[model samples]
Target: MAQSNPRKSGYSFAPSPSSLGAGLSVPVGRRSVLGGAVGLSAMAALTACGGGGGGSDVKEGTGAISFGSNQSDAVPKAAYKKMIDTFKKDSGSKVSINTVDHNTYQEQINSYLQGEPDDVFSWFAGYRMRFFADQGLAGDVSSVWDNIGDDFSEAFKASATATDGKQYFVPVSYYPWAVFYRKSVFADKGYDIPTTLDEYISLSKEMQKDGLTPIGLGDKDGWPAMGTFDILNMRINGYDFHTSLLAGEESWESDEVKDVFDTWAKQMPYHQKGGLGRDWQEMAQGLLQKKTGMAVFGMSISQQFQGAEGGEALEDLDFFKFPKINDEHGTDSIDAPTDGFMMSAKTENGGTAKDLLEFLGSAEAEQINTEADKSIVGPATNVDTSNYTALQKKAVELVGEAKHTAQFLDRDTRPDFASTVMIPSLQAFIKDPKDINNILKDIEAQKKAIFTA
Candidate 1:
């Protein structure tokens, strides 16, 4: 069910009760402040299985390392734990991890700049890491990066590098976003995955005619909608325009972005009913149950879908990349989110952090990632992905050969812009499409505030 509007922002800012469970509701008056708390709880639960011994001496060469992890799903958590355990056995040094809530993990890390600090922790690439580097909380890893092979992929490195040309983090995993659909519905309707915008719209219309919601959407968490919007915008305007907007080089009101909003307005009706208040997991349930014909979501949705309904329900479920928008950005692009690790500048165990970072890049770590199914795209460039599902393998191929792949919006832009500009603008577009100019203006103002303040 939809959560009640917090009555503070005059918007339904709380996550849907069904999404995270009944007890986790968005805070009323202090939405921003309390959002972190939800994240904190989630992170703590994820990292609970991993523990480390107390800090020890450098042992002539080795050093003690402290680590923190953002709330991750069971798979990634298990993979990380295995990696840490192996590190302890190999290096003979202490490695401690302090787990926090996923929602508030970033905030908690930011607040921990005082006395004690984790040596390394998971982080998103792009502006999120840039914020920490700017604040001097992140350590410079240029020297460490110099040792990794060029085969690790330049795109991955660039994602973790700041505009000032400093490497601050190393990405361990990434996965693409696409439309997951019920194959039986498509087979019955004689509809194949649409390759053009017109075909996509026409297909959606036909699905609606057959009494099926063509798209499953959940805006209760906000980020899911933003993810769809980002993909649509990227397809419409291409990577250059998307990058310009993210780098603050282009205004939000540009014709390119306007087209994205216009497309969303035209496609809104095909979305699942009550999507505005549904959470991502709930929306995924709709797809799994076949109540909705399709859902545009992350690769992670596969795990939840299979878990909920078993593999039989997924026998007729499949995924396809968002259809091409005139092939302007190249028809083969994929959207992915990269999660990585960054070392603290104040960490007492720089050597240990470096060891872990290097270890993460090894084939052994990649094997752990694959065994745990933590990511569809593992960090080791040399690993064979023949074991991955057909769709997963396809996504990996697309990402590998693509001319460009941008990180998702929330990670690509500064947090201030993500909160004050991108998310709000997308939400405004949903509430009132005619307010495009106002939304753009508001986002621009927020961008200015970020730079000035």
Candidate 2:
């Protein structure tokens, strides 16, 4: 099983070995990857990226470049190795590769970027990308965009661009966050897909009557629950509200945000109890065993189904865009985060970094990467969709239909707020649903301090 979480494994980008489905693609709007983690100066002493602990340079050949990768799962790791091998073959450059565990890499990114980041390194597209660009840690890739601009959708270009409007990230793949369910479970139960909040709630009640948990949630790692919160906030409050809220422009103590929690608390009876004790993989197991009806996550959820029975487990898995809560947003928005790569601003091999980024942004690189791993969709507009499975096609359609695309909560907000404040806050909310107002006030206080700093 692929075990990457944007918060857990840095997100699994390979299809579950069990499912025969082709690559998963979710075309989110204004596509970008990343969380706004620490806003430290990008010019800090080059310790992590240049140090032995980080992605240092490779002085092996006349034209050499180093790549730091976080696709740590066995399948995706192998896929990346193949990509690097192919790059070496095609470009005739001595490519040095450094691989790190996914979550570890993200956790250490600040130090990594400030230390000895590779010439090119794997990263996400949005606030995370922008945060780095704004800090001056990421290499300016406007020139690479000059060549590949028209090849991507404007949304993707927007994803690659920083707050200052310079392109710093190069997106290679993406997937959508949706409610995943077992087709067989729904088919045997004869339950229809609900479009509205009332119908969805009613459906949850029906699932409960059928002796199935309505939703499978695990927040032991703290980040999994954010998916649930993201969908609900977007559904109830709308996308713009969500973007502003994450940007720290809106008050966390508002009645609007509280309504999202109150409604969620009402549905708590149907949610898996003991969520704080379970991680997402355990929740996925509940769906696989028919103990639960559905889960809230990205296409990467399929990654949980691996091994000999992967095909059977995956064949039964299907997802729907999260149900609508309000007529205004009305299911027109989704969390479809884009994941890709960036470059160190001070890479000794500057020209080499740009060349590699150009290739990484190419349909050829997208093809190579997607073919090696089936967990995500190739981001290049021209990548071959001939091999797309029914589910992959559905994911693309779901995202393409969306009017607004939110990077997952962690990706959308400041890293400090997300990892430090929100993760524990949500986990605490799951543990004790009664302290809603206090939680909001505390979060707002922290947001004020962090944003001001």
lDDT of each: 0.66, 0.76
Best by lDDT: 2
Candidate 1 — which pairs collide? Answer: 39-101, 39-102, 39-103, 39-104, 40-101, 40-104, 41-101, 43-102, 44-100
* Poorest lDDT segment (10 consecutive residues) of candidate 2: 14-23
Model 1 bad stretches (over 4 Å): 1-61, 71-75, 113-115, 373-376, 384-387
* lDDT of model 2, residue 289: 88
Relative to the true structure, candidate 1 reaches a TM of: 0.80
lDDT of 2 by residue, 87-192 (tens): 7888887888898877667767765775667789998877778766775678788888999988887667877888777898898878888999989889999998
Error of 2 at 298 (Å): 2.3
